[model samples]
Each structure stands twice: as C-alpha cells, then as structure tokens.
Target: MARNKNRTEVKNYKKKKLTVSTSEESPAKKKKMSPKDPEDPDDALSKVESPEMKDLEDLTPEEQRKRERKLKKERKKEEKRLKRESAIDDDDEEEKPSKPSVCELSLQYLKSWSEKRKDWKFQKTRQIWLLQNMYDQEKISDDYFPILLEYLEGLKGSARDTTVKQAEDLMKEYDKSEAKAEADVQKMSRIREVLQLLS
Candidate 1:
C-alpha cells in the first residue's frame, strides 16, 4: 500500500510540472508567433516626454531666451532651404524658352539701339531705329512683326518719315537675302542631280 501511494504521488507531481512548463513555454511561443511592432521613430518620440517639456510652462527667463533662439535658428534654416529650392525652380523656368511679352520685346529692342547710339537725342527716333534693327535681324517672330510695325507707324513725329524709309530699306534687303537663299538651294539641287547622273 505504501509503494502504490508513492507511485500515485509521483504521477501527480509529474502532471503539475508538465502543466507549469507548458504554461511558461506557451507564452514564449505566443510571443514568437506574434507580429513585431513597427519601428517608427515618430511614434516612439510621441510616446516619450521631453525633459524640457515638464519645465516649459514655468521656464526661467534665461531658459526661455535659449529656447527662443533655438527655435529662431531652426526657422531661419527652413527659410534658407525654401529660398534655395525656389531659386532652383526659377532657374529651371528660365531654361525653358518662354515667349517674350510685348513690353519685354520692346524694351529689348530699345536697349539694342541705346547701346549703339549713346547720344541718340529723340526717344521717338530711338524707338524707330530699334524697330528697323528688329526687322533686319528677324528677332521678332513673323506673326508679331506686323503688329509691332503698326504700333511704330501710328507714332506721329519728325521721326515718322525716317522710320518709314528705314522700314522700306529693310524690306528690300530682306527680299534680296531671300532671293540669294533660293539661288543657293537651286545650285545645290543641280549639283546633287549631276552627282546622281555620274553615279
């Protein structure tokens, strides 16, 4: 009877050990099976309280000034970064060929003449001279040329005759250049045909 009771007690003790071991192992296994928490710095920062925050509401004047200076420095850095980015954007825009506004075109034309004639007395004459140069160089697009010409023609003064004469002279020169280009093209075609015949 003593031997049988001892056997029974040993079996109960084994069962209890198994149950305790399983309970501990099960929690560990569950921990391994569960998904890991995300590693976001912002989340961690949000959860953590800064030491400065506790004293923020009751800051001494010196501490307050230091904090203000730090904030101002960060703001200035941000502003500088933004300014640099904006300047880069502006440079990109400048690289793209944008059509000149009428005012800009007119100013460019006037500037061209002003550079040539320092003592150019009359503003009206200067404008007319600029128009003549613009037409000659083909700086203004063909579509906008007539519009500019009309604007110049509407201006009444002693410079009107000089301006009209200059326009006529430029047109004649333009026609001659066009004729010369056509002749060159014809000559090239003739040479190409002769070469083809030889081949």
Candidate 2:
C-alpha cells in the first residue's frame, strides 16, 4: 500500500514501541459521552444498547408478544387515519354544488322568459330547437311543454305553420300504427296538444 517503491527499505528496521501512560484508558476501548459535550440524540443511543434493537431470536417470548401488540396497534392507527381522510373527502364532494352545462343553462334561460318577457330576444338556435323538439314527449317535459307553447306565441308565419303541419303528420302516422308502444301513445298525446296550440 506504500505510495513510494523505495519506502520498502524501512520495513526491515524494527518498529518503534508506543508507550501508554497507566492513568489513561486503552485506545481500543469505547469512550462514554460526557455531560458537558453538546447533546446529540444519536450519540446517546450509541452509548446505551437498547433491548428493543436486538434481533428477534435474542428476545424473550413476553418481549416478542409486546412487540407484536405494538405493531398491531400501529397498523390499526394507520387504518383509522386513512378512513378519516376518505370520509372527509366524501363529505367535501357531497357539499360541493354541481354546475349546470351550457345546454341546460340555455333551456333554463328560455323557460325564464315567461317571467321576464322584456329579456326575450330572438335566438335562431333556440327557435330551431323548439321547432325540432317541441312535439317529442321525451325531449320536452310536460311542465315545460305549456311554457314553450306560450313562448311560441312570438313565432311568426312559416315556423308556426311548420310546427302545426309536423304535429298533424306525426299524429296521423301514430294513429295508423295498430300495436302502439306506451312511449308512442305519450308522443301522440303531446302532438295533439301541439296541434291544438299552433293550428
């Protein structure tokens, strides 16, 4: 391990003896931390060998049982903390109000025209939606159907006539079907209502 090759010549000479005073402890012995020294938690741990730090095989049966109980308690405490966190998250989600989409907002806006007619201005897209879905029982709820009828009082010439013609044709087509479904019967009733309103 010597860095210089020529340094091997000194190996033949006898090694110098190191003298130790009888008052001092042996160099190989471990030193105890003094009370006056700066306190270090790890230094304290190093001085005192803890029984809990020993291997499982070195532990007594009672000590092993105590350790097992401590581990079980820690696991149960962690599970309880996780359960509390998830419960808080679920409560937060329940408290939050869901925002309505653009389509639903538009429909609600049109419905509000009954109360605020001064706010009513012609929207071609909304008029088109009324013409397309006015007669469908599924698309138009019964509560909103009459409201939409009042709204259509504003519709002039062709759109009004088209709505009437469409209702008549759908009603005739539905009447011809011998084995009508419950949903079709519902639609036929709504078409009759539409024809009565617009015709």
* Every candidate's CA RMSD: 23.3, 17.2
lDDT by residue (tens digit), candidate 2, 135-178 = 66666677887788777767788888888788888888887889
Instruction: Report the number of backbone clashes for model 1.
Output: 0
Candidate 1: give the clashing pairs: none
Q: How high is the CA lDDT of each candidate model? A: 0.49, 0.62
Against the hidden reference, what TM-scores do the models get?
Answer: 0.28, 0.47
Measured on C-alpha atoms, candidate 2 has an lDDT of 0.62
Residue-wise lDDT of candidate 1 within 130-186, one digit each (tens)?
545443324444444445444454556655565555545544555477555654454
Candidate 1: residue 145 Cα off by (Å): 9.4
Off by over 4 Å in 1: 1-61, 86-90, 93-131, 134-157, 160-199
Q: Which pairs of residues collide in candidate 2?
A: none
**Displacement of the residue 199 alpha carbon in candidate 2, Å:** 1.6
Count of clashing pairs, candidate 2: 0
